[model samples]
Target: MSHRTVNFKGNPVPLEGPELKPGDTAPNFRLQQNAADGLGDATLDDFAGKTLLISVVPSLDTSVCAQQTRTFNQKAAQLPDNVAVLTVSMDLPFAQARFCGTEHIDRIKVLSDHRTADFGRAYGLLIAEGPLQRILARAVFVVGPDRKIKYVEYVPEITQEPNYDAALAAVA
Candidate 1:
């Protein structure tokens, strides 16, 4: 574990992995997507060869997280089919599905890391302590078609939103 730190509000907290940067290979992950019958599996390989905008949030219930997901949903809907948008969080698949239905989040895929914090640990966004322990840090990653990171933004404060323009531009 890299155990890097990032500020949450005014407090500093440890994270579980290295702070990723552009040109790095995007880490592989196994996450869950909601299905009508039950939770379905999703993996990094499922998105192979597509440009991806991964919006990471601590939870969708928070205001900033909701707004961040909604912002990306709208932005991504206008993008080409080869570009895909995903929002990963600690929320369960059922909760994520409920949020998507309530928020009209059809343009993007809202995934769950609650089963296992694989995405968080892999991306270095897993909060390691304090009130938010086990939750993912607020961040954004743009993975190019080659599965290399094209952009990375770790929001300095967990309550804040990421740079929408910069991430969207990375996809363009």
Candidate 2:
């Protein structure tokens, strides 16, 4: 399904929360893995003392989102061992697992926000209206080993890819 149409090549949309910036502390999140019961098995504290890259996307079923995840999976392998990457989306866990299995996405952890949209709202990347309403706007956050955000990029265009170089640099 189309995440964004050609007509909406680049349009501003309403978002839900405060836009996080560098030096801001990354919020602790407990995201769901294989269930939609509104509970999470993975928490931010799980990666304590490690650099974390949170890649937020609308839906993995879409082309841009899929490519973004795949790109990060490749990039993750080259990152420092202390760095952990996560791809968050509203897609159900089943679909996410299937996508990872088919695409050989083994490096980063792919989690679902369909449970509570907690991650989206907390990160201020939730599209509150438009065609992508209820979905997450593309964003990347790099949290340092101290859990402080070292970089933040809220991709202006919903349909476009994020700045991989900038995010990767922040991790370094």
Candidate 3:
């Protein structure tokens, strides 16, 4: 059970798992990737030695989510190569691939959480109730090369965007 709550269009929605904070070691999670060999599992170990910026969203089909992904994709190029930005959502691998293709989102890797929801449960962003149940709330996390969480932001409102400046500054 999670004590933290987020608003989805003014209604409070419960979330599961412990809310992560700076200095906490990031939990290793296995998320699915769209691949020719079927779905492949990508873990935090896959991005070893890099500063990871995780952008969590509910779905790519929604306008705000799409914009969030695009914004991160655009900002990714400006950051150092050691910084890897990943957008995680509950959408299927195929859907995530199509969205990336259509949106020209190549810089940032968009991963699917539909398979195990490990990323959501580990990050404590999994919405536990309401129409958006099972979806991840909008959030941002920056994990340093040593695997310690440098920053975490769980947006109070589901419909709004995260504080990109602060999140990016944490990486610097």
Candidate 4:
């Protein structure tokens, strides 16, 4: 587990796994998605040969998390077609699908880590303990086509928004 800590409403909480840094290869992860056919698996390779902007959130039910997802959804339109934006959370696939439908989110892909916590553990965003136990911390990662991370932001405060401009600039 990583020694990293983040705040939630000014309360400090520990995080698991080593914090990822720039230049490091983005770890591969499998997330679940609710589809018309049924539940499906989405892996890092699904976006191979494209730049990936990953938005990590604890849950979409929260205001901050919803905003984060919506923001990236809008931003996805401006990015090149080869760039894929994904919103990952510990929420159940059913909840994620509902949120996207209710929020009218279409541009970005919403993935669930509830089943395995694979994304959370691999990315080091899992909140070890707190009221929001087992949830992910707010963070963002931009991985280039080659799979090397170009930008990373582990937001100090989970309630705040990530640096959208800086992350977008990295892709541009």
Candidate 5:
């Protein structure tokens, strides 16, 4: 079946099956992030040689986004130390940091896409047209230590949560 097309905020976007698979090389991505230390930038290489749980959320301020991040953070704590849980969102770095602080979230790393929506666009998470214009849809991708996509979950609703169990199992 063909994937869905939707606009987020205002940008046009297409949701497509990943071009890279579990055995295929995961695509490289550079992202802006908010850390406890401060604003920083990261790339796919940063998570190389380790399992990666990439939880893509629309915005950290939203209810679904908050729940998604919380769930991932909880799960990340249970995973091996070498595994990294990275939550990517379109929220500003400052906003992300505030959300983490408000929620007392520490297990997962929150990455921002405010400077450039490159990671969202590259992963086909950016919605094309909608009230959430420029924001991403809820999606999850699990990458193995070798940087291959081991699992993928793209929520049908813009406000729904991804299948945490399946995504987590892929990492396990």
Candidate 6:
């Protein structure tokens, strides 16, 4: 009984584990972004002391990906200032910034992992052995102000969406 990797566009990518859960300390890693605005870097500590919603997406160009980001951006408007909603993806920063502008998604931050795949590997979202190798799964994690995972949802099917309500409730 071995866990299989995820595939994207017919490529293989490996997942570190079956799933992540509440009370887990999100593995620490850095995210790299090469946005036209300039390069940006962030680690777990950058989001500490805030309710963190890490929305992991495979890519930002797809409808589901767009929906997932917009869904949280809409929700972020309702949450307190102390809560931070971050959408993580392998998409280039330029594309993310473009999408944000087009969608008017200002409430949340879109972080990229173009320079390094540490984010995917650390979070166990990297799909091993697929056309989308090294891409992250459609996973969501809610981390409390203390940096402990308050909730988590890793979509079993890469093509599916994460549980938005569950992620929001985790913060609530």
Q: Who wins the TM-score comparison?
A: 4
Model 4 bad stretches (over 4 Å):
none
Candidate 2 off by > 4 Å: 1-8, 35-40
- lDDT, candidate 6, 40-140, per-residue tens: 88888887788898999989888988999999999999998889999999888888888899999889989998777778767778765545666678889
lDDT by residue for model 4 over 1-172, one digit each (tens)? 4478999889889998878999999999999999999999999999989999999988899999999999999989999999999999999999999999999999999999998877888898988675778999999999999999999999999999999999999887
TM-score of 4: 0.97
Candidate 3, residues 1-172, lDDT tens digits: the string is 5578999899889998888999999999989988778878889999999999999999999999999999999999999999999999999999999999999999988888897777888899898776888899999999999999999999999999999999999999
Could you say which candidate leads in lDDT?
3
Candidate 4 global Cα RMSD:
1.0
- lDDT tens digits, residues 24-87, model 5? 6667887887665877899998876898899989888888889999988888878998899999
lDDT of 1 by residue, 8-116 (tens): 8878888998889999999999999998888898888999889999999999999999999999998887899999999999998989999999999999988899877
> Sort by lDDT, best first: what order?
3, 4, 1, 2, 6, 5
- Predictions in order: lDDT: 0.91, 0.85, 0.92, 0.92, 0.78, 0.81
Q: Model 3, stretches more than 4 Å misplaced?
A: none
| Candidate 2: residue 105 lDDT (0-100) | 90
Candidate closer to the true structure by TM-score (higher is better), 2 or 3: 3
Better of 2 and 3 by lDDT: 3
Error of 6 at 32 (Å): 2.2
TM-score of each: 0.96, 0.90, 0.96, 0.97, 0.86, 0.88
Each model's Cα RMSD: 1.2, 4.4, 1.1, 1.0, 3.6, 2.7
